[model samples]
Target: MIPKINGLGRSFAGVAAYCLHDAPTPDERSPETSERVAWTDTRNLATIRAERAARLMAATAKAAPDLKRLAGGSRGGRKLAKPVLHYSLSWARDETPDRREMSRAVDGSLEALGLDGHEALVVAHEDTRHPHVHVVANRVDPETGKAATLGNSKLRLSRWAEGYEREQGRIRCEERVKNNERRRAGQELVRTPWERPRHWARVRRERMVPGRARRARGPRDEERVDMEAWRRVEAEAWETVADGRWRSLRHLETRAREEWVELHRRQEEMRQRLDRESRTVLGRLRIWRTERSLRELAGAIRGRQDLVEGWREDLDGYHRDERAELGKAHGERAREIERGWHKFYRSRLVEAERRAWAVRETMKERQETRERERGPSIIIPIPRPRQPRGPERGGGGFER
Candidate 1:
């Protein structure tokens, strides 16, 4: 099935245009485009120029979005512009025309075209080609957004085509050719290329033509002449039809080639798209990684700051404790010095009193000895007590 691309994004605007019933992702590039739009029946051998292809695709997209599905295959719910489907059929290679061979070719082409639906409607009838059939279907769908649909179906188109050929001087050879015919006598037979391939031109031919008479009369002079004339007309018509058929086949071959080119273009685009998307994702990832790394670095820095702040606070506390202990020790040393001074002063005062008492006792003893000899009232002239000496400067005995 043709992979869908609904609305164009990126470089996809007109690239997804045409889709054959057997077409792969009509909107996408074919294997021929990039070794990726697979060719089912025939290998896509050539490529169309990029510019031309883009233009044709643009036209197709504009004409119809669901062109591929409208042609036949069921494409679910995706609303797309119908793509224009143009095709013509010819022999595979070195093949020619015969009734049986022609029928088989036509049948094969129909199958190859892959008519899952569509191809049923026809307004006229045509018949042509003795051993081959030529089909022309305009890819335009009116009822839907798809290209033209063939509404009348196979049996209907085939019969109509036979009638169409008869009108064009090319006779219908199919067994069931009357169904789509205008049967009324007054009604004129319409020769349309939709059913049969024919060349329309004004030419004078004898009544003895193949189409002029369906059955031949008995063997007689008049019958013989008419038969001969009829044979001649049939020959001429075949030549004209053959020429026309050849041209049409060539045209179809060209269209097929164009389609191959279109497929190739899309394939290349697909590869590019995939590459582009991958690169975009990588770029975004790189940016995200860089940003994440920056964020982590910032967080680590903030944590370190907190640790330093705590250390600073601890150091201040330690200094304050040291100062308090040192101050206490200093006060204790001052008190000990005061105590030592007070003790030294008290000892000096006590020593002075003891010396004074000893002096008194010595004096009393002398007086007692004197009394034993004489009266105890001996006048002892103990010089008055000298004053305690202190630090003095030198001074002469005489008043100077």
Candidate 2:
């Protein structure tokens, strides 16, 4: 089994829509092979989304309030961030695990990630030859209102998968086995160059082109500029600024300016080195030579160019990974700051509500006291004296 854990996402509804409905194309959707493995609740997509949203809201509402004052106003509650964890498990092309096995694998993987009991929607897709199941789980625990710790989650899942493969008596993946061994020995997991998706794509494309076509294409100069290196430096700078040791955000900004200056200095140094190397290599190539010497020099230049390109690509990949890690760290730090602001706002809101309630109670008590102090006053009805009736119409002159 090959387990691919995707990135942490924000929108539960969006993910649910994609996994349950949007995953299969129209032709594949007619068969309706999507199965809800572990969702005990209603199967309606809208209902599931609403329930999950409500659960997330409840969890966030119950989070403990932090009273620390921050410069920015609290807006974190306006949107949910990184609550969705989507991943998939695929079997070998020849091996088709039954639904029961797939369910077990899903549960096992979730358990490995410390999210077994969390709300998860598992959907099996039969659109491809290889049977695979996609799992979308909420990272936030509904009960405790705490996000599950995801430290070394990839390694943990890989270990679980390895054991699972052994139990199934399947051919073990050598790469995964080596990675597990490395993990056990406290060594960093190393990925081969081709393991990079983009690098692999480039390799595959190159392989597809005919040799004649490739030769005709000639050698095109790749931009020697390393953008990934600059991105890595910038990401590292932000991460450094976001570190907890800083007295305040303002102080962090000041430190960031210093890092920025240092980055520019390094950039200048790199530019000068590139210039010197380019001039030296070009100057040597410009010298006239015999046809044999020319051919030999051409071959040498090509070999050196290939070596340099390979080195550059490898370095770029390393820098890309570094930037990604730094970016993730910076995001976590930013989320922490946002959460602090959120808690602070929640605490302030609660205090305001309490004060308002106390004021209302005080007003009610004063009204009651005033009513009690003023006793009721009695009023007797007073009748006015009746006027003498006017003389009858017929006997006006006579006294009746």
RMSD of each candidate? Answer: 57.5, 27.1
User: Candidate 2: misplaced stretches above 4 Å?
Assistant: 24-80, 188-190, 193-400
Error of 1 at 285 (Å): 75
Return the lDDT, model 1, position 326: 47
Each model's lDDT:
0.37, 0.56
TM-score of 2: 0.40
Q: Output candidate 1 Cα RMSD.
A: 57.5
Writing each residue's lDDT as its tens digit, candidate 1 over 1-400 gives 0011122221212222222112345575443332221221211112233223434434444545455457674545444444433333332222234445444444443443443232311111112221112232223332243543333234333553454445445553543444334422222235555533321210011111123222222223332233444344444444554454345444543453354445445545644543443345453344335446554343334444443344345544554465445434433433343344335434433433344344445566777877788855658788986754434333533444
**TM-score to true structure, per model:** 0.19, 0.40
Provide the lDDT at 393 for model 1: 33
* Candidate 1: segments with Cα more than 4 A from true spot: 1-59, 62-146, 153-156, 168-172, 178-400
The candidate maximizing TM-score is 2
Tens-digit lDDT string for candidate 2 (1-400): 9899877776666665666643456567433333533332212123455336434533443341221112233324323357678899999899968878888898899889998767677777776788888887776555544567686777788889999999998745988898778655545456765442222222242221112211111112213223343334434433443342223433433443354445445545654554454345453243213223554475435446553444346545665575456445544553455455445444443444444455556667898899888867679989997755547445565584
